[model samples]
Target chain A: MDRLVESTRELLWERGYVGTSPRAIQQRAGAGQGSMYHHFSGKPELALAAITRTAAELRAEAERQFAAPGTAVERITAYLRRERDVLRGCPIGRLTQDPDVMADPALRRPVEETFTWLRTRLAAVLTEGRDRGELDAALDPSATASTIVAVLQGGYVLARAQNSPAAFTEAVDGALGLLSTASRTPRSG
Target chain B: MDRLVESTRELLWERGYVGTSPRAIQQRAGAGQGSMYHHFSGKPELALAAITRTAAELRAEAERQFAAPGTAVERITAYLRRERDVLRGCPIGRLTQDPDVMADPALRRPVEETFTWLRTRLAAVLTEGRDRGELDAALDPSATASTIVAVLQGGYVLARAQNSPAAFTEAVDGALGLLSTASRTPRSG
Candidate 1:
């Protein structure tokens, strides 16, 4: 059962929801057809389990950066600079491109909740920074948070489009640069 | 032949390369299988034609904003603020998520070229802005251009995830605000 769900996650990441099939999942998991059916009702159920797990993992990973010791900018910088599979793209963000995944609310909930949580969490960090006078008074925490999240998501798009991580790195650097301008503390070279 | 290519473009946008099928393309185009084969070798040929056309259209649309009379900030603002089908996502950017599309060099060429062109064009505009002393000396045109492009691409992902355009709008507004800080002339309310 674990292998089946794990294989579904891998296939979904590689081929998306519509392209992933029960046969493929079973084959990849080394589970027989009967074993697969015994585990889940169908592909949708299996996919939901996989997606849910992936979303949880993403949040846990991000929380580590957000909860780490740092100022708002430093925390965000850490998150942005953190190592990522730039080429494979964001597991949750990539699902937005899948018609099958987006059309189903059950499958889409995790994706939606994940972004909402990220934006809200980032905003809180920025708000804390502002209260501490670390960020400019003019910075809108929520809006800035969205931009920060968007950069990562969009960076993946650029990287995948060019088949190189260069674009993604440049985007992160550019975002960090712009974000620094919003810092109340004058950055030193 | 025209109808076939147009239909393929629409299907590719709606369903992506992997999900779209030749039969669906023919049916949507009102062209028979024979007609499809007559004009193109197969799905790959038809898809290339469609993607090529889509890439061209995207460039033309973006060029209008980039070419309009405006300051560097205003031009970038115009490009970012231009009314878009926020829910549908970017025609060209969306293709980056299609694994099959990315795997094929011929298919991926237009996607790569479009972004390279967009980044170069945006960098040129930023360079002009910096040269005119409209932007800060510290700005890196190439990297900043990638961030701008990434925001749009990432904004689409956000909007689609929430099934609302609000995230996309917020991202743009946030980006514009961050960009304003880099302006030499103080922004007026």
Candidate 2:
């Protein structure tokens, strides 16, 4: 049972909800029909568990970077610098592109929750910075938080399309540059 | 035959390359296997036609906005303001998420060519602005061009994940704000 769920997670990350097949999961997990069926009703039930697990793990890792002691700038920079396979699409973003996953609310909830938590976490960091006068007071924390998350997700898409990690690096650097600009007060000199 | 190809183009845009299947295309196109195979070799061939067709159209639409008569900033601002269904994801970005598509150069060429052409096209416009003294000579045309593409691609990911268009808007606004700053010469009191 444990192995079946674990294997689904790996396959989900690699193949997405639509591309993955029940046969693939059964084969990868080394489980037969009886074993998989005993643990769950079917593929959808198994996938739900896998998505929930991945979402939790992703959020925990992101929280570590955001919770680090620093102003919003350092924490976000740290999050971006956290080494990633730039050419690989984000697991969560990849799921959104999966027509099957997006169509089924059962499968979509975990994905929605994961990103929701991430945006909130990122927004908190931005809010803290704004309150401390470390970020421009006019900066909308929620909107800015959404943008940060979008840039990283979008960066992966661009990098993969170009077949070069340079695209990802340039995009991230550009985003971080925006952060630096916000930290500096604009006053008529 | 033409109807099948057109159906495929619409399917690719909505469901992505991998998410789409021959059965779906045929079903949507109201064509049978014999009709489809007579028109193209197989799924990949049909997909290639659809993808290439889409890439050409996307480029034409983008060029229309970028090449409009105006200062570079005005043109780019219009390009960004162009109405888009952000949560649906870019047709090209959807291709990037497909591992099968990325692994095959023949399938990948149209996508690659589209973005490359887009970046260069945008750069030329920016360069023109620089030469005309509409934009600061200090601007790096290539970097800014990549930034523009990244923000739109990334904005789609954000919008899709959050299930809100606000994130896409925020990211676009943020990137535009940066471009606006870049266009302005350094302030002197």
Candidate 3:
């Protein structure tokens, strides 16, 4: 990973899109202004690179969960069960809260694409489970996929608001319960 | 609403709790430094007033939808259907995204209270329906209430990420559908 990309990621995590500045990124990266500008046109260009790189990593991480050898239920449950710092919120979802990021199409494109790709990928995984008879054939894979994503994102919001991770866990648990309950082939109570 | 309080609310909305400054508020409110200090000791007082006022309005809005004359399904559905600037996100939920707001108990009190109050109020309405045979007695009203709120907050995150309202509506529709499906008490299919 390039130093500039790493610096942008750090700035993004700390100051957010609105608060971050190009000069700050250059200083953080240990690169002079010319060196920074040589690699990217400006802050938007640098931000796009950082956001896309983050998006790729997110996909790869999710793929690890999706590709795990287990029942569809086992895999998805494992995916949701990944260790996360619930208090910090999702880096991608956190950008949604920043007005500047949302206002800029260049920045928003990667964020939008990431979630869109995630939902599609998740739905595909669910579809395969339904096909293999691991999940209920009656389940709406796409809808369930959206619900899964919503629970995670919404859990962050609830947890952040309360300044406790309890709400995040509850929401996740509730969504998982829904999936199991709604499963055509119930495993066990 | 005093000039200072009004200014505080507007600034909180635009700059958020962390980004807003006393100097900016005074400038926007067209008040002198001494006059601003005279009305409120500092940012904390002004912010508390602003947050409290915002919470009250948010509750009133929810009550308007939840307390409307209709079946329980109708009322819940109405609440979900209420028009919103999905892109802008909920004013209360917006506070949750602010690090400073969540860190300070003084700042977080209204936000915490707002969601707590919303969940309680929603649960009460749900419980009423359970008693009246409009909903399943087996339903966990409080948990379901929390999930509904989560969906709205998450919808805002999705919408902002996409730079469009589509994801927000999809999330809302998905949650509302869950509510409909969960209703053991029959509604027209």
Q: TM-score of chain B only, all predictions? A: 0.94, 0.91, 0.93
- Pairs clashing in candidate 3? none
Put down candidate 2 lDDT per residue, B30-109, tens digits, no spaces. 99999888888888998899888889889889989987999899999899879997777688777887777888899888
DockQ of 2: 0.45
Q: In candidate 2, residue B20 scores what lDDT?
A: 87
| Model 2 stretches with alpha carbons more than 4 Å out | A18-27, A31-39, A185-188, B1-8, B11-46, B69-71, B126-140, B180-189
Interface RMSD of structure candidate 3 (Å)? 4.1
Residues A1-48 of candidate 2 have per-residue lDDT tens digits of 888889998988777776578889999999998888888998899999
lDDT of 3 by residue, B83-149 (tens): 9888777888888877888789988988888888988888888788878877656567777777777
For every model in order, the TM-score on chain A comes to 0.94, 0.93, 0.93
DockQ for all models, in order?
A: 0.55, 0.45, 0.39
Best-to-worst lDDT order: 1, 2, 3
Each prediction's RMSD to truth: 3.0, 3.6, 3.3
Give per-residue lDDT, candidate 1, residue A161.
91
lDDT of 1 by residue, B1-189 (tens): 999999998888777787689999999999999999998999999999999998899899989989999899999999999888999889889888787899999999999999999999999999999999998888889989999999999999999999999999999998988888777765444
Q: What C-alpha lDDT values do all the predictions have?
A: 0.92, 0.81, 0.81
> Considering TM-score, which of the candidate structures 1 and 3 is the better prediction for this target?
1
Expressed as tens digits, the lDDT of each residue in A96-135 for candidate 3 is: 8767887888888899998898788888888988898766
